[model samples]
Target: MKNRTILLTGGGTAGHVSLNQALIPELKNLGFNVEYIGSKDGIESGLIPDSFPDVPYHAIASGKLRRYFSVKNFTDPVRVGAGLVQALNVIRKTKPVAIFSKGGFVSVPVAMAGKLMSVPVIIHESDVTPGLANKIAMPFANHIFTVFKETLKHVPKEKSTCTGSVIRSELMDGSAAKGKEICNFNNDLPVLMVMGGSQGSAVINEAIRSNLTALLKQYNVIHLCGKGNADSSLMDLANYKQFEYVTHELPHLLHMTDFVVSRAGSNSIFEFLALKKPMLLIPLSKLKSRGDQILNARLFQQQGFAHVVEEEELTPERFLAEMQKLQMDEDLLVDAMTNAESPKTAYEMAKLVAAHTKN
Candidate 1:
């Protein structure tokens, strides 16, 4: 069977790549060949090639247009302008049937190139709040998919579809039983999963530390500590599992977890929902993160999948108190998560893009 070529572009973080990753398998199942286009700096560089060796990888150079100022921002436009030209050359060479973008600064060039080349350019917005890049690209896109209904306000309604988030489907119905055994966890006890996105969350780690002794008495903790936090032994308890990184065991980790504590990155949010686990989201507000995490958590809070604890309010006491509330209300939490849209996300997104692209 001949495969239709799809040129997928997106990534500055795992949020973008995770969505891209989900679609690759789905698109391929439909007898389509997928190629990736992203920048050198993002996690996509390492993840894309490793995850899908069958796919061709293309790289573009770009400097982020941060919401805040730096010397880099001043020079980014020229670099990105060059990227647009280079990406145009790639689109001309590959002649892909369609382009799917998970918008970030890096996606700008290729999305623009697709527009110039008269290719169908589809974008998927992963957050409740659209980022600066996606907001700009909306007008030019043939179709745009957003995870949040709120994003429609920022993006042109004509170009956008609220499809929820695209996540790996098997996660929706998978059992955490296997993970419980692999992690050497006890099923009788509740397991709390703490992760700070793909890179790890230091604030979450510190908060856990301050409250660890208290938390351990009630919950078995599984912490993905990025690559640099103290080892699992730091817990000084027998019930905790800690890892600097656990790419292979991520699903299992989520499966075995009774609940989650994570940053507001969209990938983590959807994954937790896919697992139907309750979560406490602590958004990054200290830097130029632009409160994407905050917005993500706020939406889920409105839906009852999570509770938002701002960094300022995220002390050991508050963290523990929040967990206690969730523990007390576990059944309601489960009901809320089970009712949330998920598992069919990639299929929903793929169907939308396919129909639009065909038109």
Candidate 2:
């Protein structure tokens, strides 16, 4: 186990990249050389190398698995297959001890290639419901790790471990508190952190756009306005901090904020729990992206971790009302954060996979 090489592949969005990022430094800390493989068009291209400047960076043409008709859908698999071949070559050259996957089409190839090369393969499902990529990679993977207890049904009992979803160590490892001066607000006012999960939900932005003034009256907001959505003309905001990408300050903002209005991406949901911040979670609808978010949000709501709402059900009025309700039920917030899963069990998955490689 001394200085073994490990290759990790996942990302088109930050949800996947963040999980990949969470595990890298820790793996390096354990004395493994780490390489990241991601889509050239995805968040990984920027986030991965930046976070681990010294680590090797590789890009593949990968994409989302769309539910409905799109011109781009047909060509995605072909591009992904090419990336898979490329990933296989990288693995052959590195001879990694394990391939860690976090559910991206980019990862599908990496996981498969690892299995084919007789290297260990471990896949971590960040959602309560597994993604299509995970579904495809499950059979080849030697072990599975997940954030939720429910994901076990989708994975073999022998191979699956509930380690929670691994958030970046910089994030959930009791390091969430930080410089209050950067936020520029008193400890009295509530801070609402709004996240759209890597792409910045247009619908969430619309809701906030319609009520920025109302939001400012009660709370200070730090909004992660995905790549192109930070339109200042939408509504003049006071006490609002906007970022196209805030790769570094996620945990600090989570700690500083009293509440959140967020998309219920599995990774995001787990972070809210880790921080014990009450959330008004809006799951993208059933018709959206294989309904993974909808499935994930329902599971979290069932566990009483967050109050779930659909984007269609969210309005400025609804958000304000939910805020009032959450403000009243302050006790529930603390109770919900005592969740069963954790994000640090990636080490457990690694050990299991490494064992399989021996066999």
Best lDDT among the predictions, by candidate number: 1
Clash pairs (backbone) in predicted model 2: 164-342, 165-343, 166-343
lDDT for model 1, please: 0.80
lDDT of 1 by residue, 1-359 (tens): 24567899888777777778878888887767789998986888888999899999888987687777688887999989988988888887887878998887888888888888889989888887788888777766898887787888887787778887667775655557777776676547788888876777778889987887888888888888786775645745678888877665677677767888888888778778877788888888856477888888888888888877898878778888888888787788789988876455676666676776532
Per-prediction TM-score, please? Answer: 0.92, 0.90
- Which 10-residue window in model 2 sums to the lowest lDDT? 172-181
Query: What would the per-residue lDDT of candidate 2 be over residues 200-226, giving only the tens digit for each residue?
Result: 888888787688888888888888878
Tell me the number of clashing residue pairs for each predicted model: 0, 3
Supply candidate 2's per-residue lDDT for 100.
80
Stretches of candidate 2 off by over 4 Å are 1-3, 71-74, 172-179, 233-238, 339-359
